[model samples]
Target: MKLEDASSGSLGPVIEVIQSILNQTGYILPALVLFIIALAIKYPNRLPGTTDPKHRPGVYFPPGADPLIGHTRMIVGFGSEGQFENFKALSDATPAGSWNVSFLGTSSMTFVNRPEYLEYIQKTNFDNFPKGSQFTGRLGDLLGVTGIFVADGHPWKTQRKQASHMFSNREFNTWVRAVIHNELDDISALLDNVTAKNGPGKLILPELMFRYTLSSFAKMAFAANLNCLSPDPDSLKRPVPFAVAFDRAQAIINDRFITPGWYIWEKFNKTGRDMRSSIKTIREFGLDIIHKRLAERQDEKKDPLAPVEGTKKEQLKKEGKDLLDFFMDLTTDPEELLIVVLNFIIAGRDTTAQSLSWLFYELMAHPEHVPKIRKEIAEKFGEPEGGVRLDYESFRELPYTVACLHEAIRLHPAVPKNGKAVMKDDVIIPQGPNPDNLPPVRVFAGERVGWSDWVMARTPAIWGADCEEYNPSRFLETDEAGKLHLRNFGQWKSHYFNAGPRLCLGMNLATYEATAFIAAVLPRFNFEWATAAQGQKSAWPPQYANSVTHPIKDPYLVNVTRVKA
Candidate 1:
């Protein structure tokens, strides 16, 4: 089925769920009444010097910020690319490579683009910068309050420790590789069928990638074959409803971050109502999955044929344990299980899927790299017909292919923007001596600080003058053997997977899956821009949706053909 059909199967129950959420706003009414009173006091700036905006020292307050509305107009009005341009302009305006803007005169937000400031908040003083209440509050309803993504302090540590097992274990790595290989085989078959039936299909790449990654992750995480990549359209409907609702909920929640006093306006807006309904559907589906897994575990325990106690890990190695099995060992509470599982899905699926979609875009833009990538794959795994799959160790040897993937993300990071809240007053210091005359910027408690990897990715100082160019060679270096090797551009320079204590838990798994996918498909299929009708430009320099992740605004239409080899 097409991506649009994900929510098509059944909506009668969803509408009922929406009405149920709308009807149960008992406390929301009182909050709305208080908000009205607050608005009366807040809207008309009564303080002295309120007619003109007041600027703070060491802060670049760009034009168009009204004293009454602040930057709310741009935040709400601008598209994703426009917003990126605004931040890029701000980064260029200051030597410190960061800027601040007020919101509704009540709160201020700082946008950090420099590597020094990024390290300061994400790594150096990580404890002081947690995903505080403001950030978590925006996401609490969708991603549960206690999930690893929303949690801070001890709760986050506990979940992180438990989840770390999957990445650290060698056996689990091998198991994950086999699962990815299996998924890629299925994708190849589906594409092969399409090519046989028709000459070349105009594929929406992001949709296809998302489905492939979702199905792959579902198997590794829950041992459930969602078959979201099924050729049979009817079989695809079962999981599409939950997938659609999940995607909608994430996009809406991300908007809450920039919308000033969002909680106040959300109650009365259509966006807010849609968010509530989406959350209801998401939670219902998640709870059902959790409960069914729990029941299966109970049945496993009673089976006399189950693995003996001491050999359980070995048995899991052979049978391939899902992430849910690990979490079940940690907690029996259904709510907690649901939160972690959903968080796992977001981490394991969305980021990598988006990254690969953009990778293909990069490949299309620079088709010369296609032969290079395919040659490297052939050297390592023979040819597509040979059916040789890269395991955990062998996948690491394809340095050039991995470099292309790295460079693609360097330009278009999946999680392009991330931030942390200040716990107390602090001064942000640049890493090097004050060469640019960049002064230290003081930040107070209760303020938010964010960094845009998108801007940093294109910064002239960080990546030289040709930073905008798509060149995979930048991520490689010649070693003693005279062969190209992947450069280790540490966390600060390569901050896509994040850094410090809150680093991405699924980084290794994501890398393995993406590289393996490139290996699998490049040898068998070719991609290029889909032909456009007269007067159209084929959506060059792709536009992105203003969502939680960097999703292509429209369908990423591409021409897919089979290789003659």
Candidate 2:
């Protein structure tokens, strides 16, 4: 046969076979897609590990959620600024304050916004719910894999046991108070310089608060001065490398919570690169601090009494060393030491600073409360004469001042949301009598449970009718003697520093630091929103920056006028 004819004869059958297969696939493709859709619709809850709708009859699943992604779009849609709006809406939609939804198809999250459920999860059945891989996987790089924040079970227990000393030690706490005072001197100097240079309100209080707390924490934890709260005009304008990197890393880490397949994209994306660079800066700074301490420790070992001890104060200082000293005694591993110290930095720096920013913002917005706080401060310290100095004992006397702090935290919790993974199939029984009449919801192993203190802070059932209002009075009571006392709202209701075993290690220190600033500063200087006071109302509920902690968003400027003695 001719070459062309021979080729055509051989190719014809193969081409026909190919054509037949393509034609069949054309019909089969649509049928397969339709079948998958129908299957999804029919058995939306039929996945191997999802909670069946029938099983969670009491829970509200927000409508318009994709069968696969569930309410993930609601989470990932908004930037950090509006991140919690959807959660607020969801909380409002379900009066009972419990909801179940999936994130990446198979992974499920059960939210318990009620305070009682929080008590059950955090205290009653604490062990069943660990922080889980979902949380550790995202935050591990920045927070450290074995850090106190990420550790569970025995490691957590051991870390907690050792770390508790800083909070509980009388002498150490006194040192922390002294450190806060020293840092405040820098803040005061900055405020004076800024107001003099640019007039009142040149200072952004949140930024200043972060700087103040970073400096305080560095001293209190590491005994190394970062000088983060420098008064220099140029320094005020420029970001501190360690502080900037720490905050940036946390903000980036917050993104991973909502970004689907974040791991895959983060490996190749600018955001991921930025996060790594930030973390590297943090790690290097941490290691540098660790190495210096190790060197000093070795020297101390060489000559036990080389550093001469002075007075009672010096003895106490030596007896109650900083957090780094405490951890250095426990382990010499630089990485481990860095992890624990960084975890406390989050507690010392971010939580206290953000809490104070929110507290002061509310105080500035509602100046009516400022007088009450000042009045309480004066009552406790006897008129701020010669500038009142607060010791550890003094903090206990300012119940009203502490109440105001608690109230502000209730409205704007630093750590707004937290969760734990369910170890096995279990049911959550609402605490109290279940006023909302919510039924028990069953959770399977591998699923996670979460609580939004931010939403709970606004829930009427939890905080009463004036939940949205910035009312510190809700956390207080008037005695027959006409004295204001803070009512114990318990850990679950307050829920800012958390509750039970995982309760924030630095809660006492945080309270002391923030209240000291408020007591000392508020008594001496008036903090007013410079622009907002000029007839423009600040946002009714202050907006927050999306970070590991909920910080007041920008435009945090405040005028600091010295209160007449």
Q: Pick the candidate with the highest TM-score.
A: 2
Model 2 misplaced regions, further than 4 Å? 1-49, 78-81, 197-201, 304-319, 382-386, 532-541
Q: Report model 2's TM-score to 2 decimal places.
A: 0.88
Going through the candidates in the order shown, the clash numbers are 0, 0
lDDT of 1 by residue, 411-463 (tens): 88888887788888787776644456656666767777888888898898888
* lDDT (Cα, 0-100) at 48 in candidate 2: 30
For each candidate in turn, the TM-score is: 0.85, 0.88
Candidate 2 lDDT over residue span 359-443, tens digit each: 8877877888877777778876776443466776577788878888888888888898888899988888877777678767678
* C-alpha positional error of residue 50 in candidate 1 after TM-score superposition, expressed in Å: 12
lDDT for model 1 comes to: 0.74
| lDDT value, candidate 2, whole model | 0.75
Worst 10 residues of 2 by lDDT: 307-316
